[model samples]
Target: MYSPIINISALEPLYLPHEMPTCHRIRAKKEGAPAEAVKGRRPTDVTIAQNLRPEVNIWREADYPGASDTTRELLHHWFGRDHSITTADGEVIPFRY
Candidate 1:
């Protein structure tokens, strides 16, 4: 799966340790996309595509502050599915394991 880091806290800007030079390009068109999305990209920064659709996964309602209606739906879907996650302190937050 082509899983790009959707979590802002998960990485720092211009600090993608795994990306190969000029191997991938990113184009974001949603308000949910982090502002540093382009800045985090390397060697291929350009105008974003109009039809870009990135999958936003809101693990916790508190995590995503300014989610749109469509993004809220995704939150509802994932929350409904009872996905579980561990915090930095190693505590499980969700109901499922």
Candidate 2:
């Protein structure tokens, strides 16, 4: 369970298109016309993508003394997972960021 630690501290909020829908919904076609497109005067509710700023991990790789390959890999994996936030119900939400 390699949970990702989405460090929002260095991340930037993803902005949506100004023209993106705020709440405009699609309508079903009537008579014999093709599918109607989603159109409205107001914007529709849509979410934009999340992105990290600088988008680079500047951490320097350090060597652990006397650590075995399997043990080191396991520690690295578990350590990463441990940093992820958990819900009160104990459900590990993957990609919840």
Candidate 3:
């Protein structure tokens, strides 16, 4: 069982652009659409897209040293079965796939 020393760091967040009119139109289709829901006015699709920032690392050249083919392969293979990874600094982070 070869477990690599994973480095834990905050990678840059990825922002995806959304089609506003399409989103608004879709939202408009839903019945009983309220100007405000629960806490506040439901955020528009544009707002939701802006706030939906995610940092992703793939098993390729994209993230480099921070990511590797071996790591991705292992993670994918052991994901649900193993459930965790030991970082370089010795932190055992639990991940759900």
Using TM-score, give the best candidate's number: 2
For each candidate in turn, the TM-score is 0.20, 0.22, 0.20
lDDT tens digits, residue span 1-97, model 1: 8766676642443533323232333554665565433432244244343223122223353655677878977866765466667999999876531
Candidate number that wins on lDDT, 1 or 2: 1
Q: How do the residues 45-89 of candidate 3 rate in per-residue lDDT, one tens digit apiece? A: 795554553232232224435657788667557542535789999
lDDT of 2 by residue, 26-84 (tens): 33355433333344333425422212211212221353446788876775675444335
The C-alpha RMSD of each candidate to the native structure, in angstroms, is: 14.9, 17.8, 18.1
Q: Rank the candidates by TM-score, best first.
A: 2, 1, 3
Which parts of model 3 have CA positions greater than 4 angstroms off?
1-82
Model 2 misplacement above 4 A: 1-61, 82-97
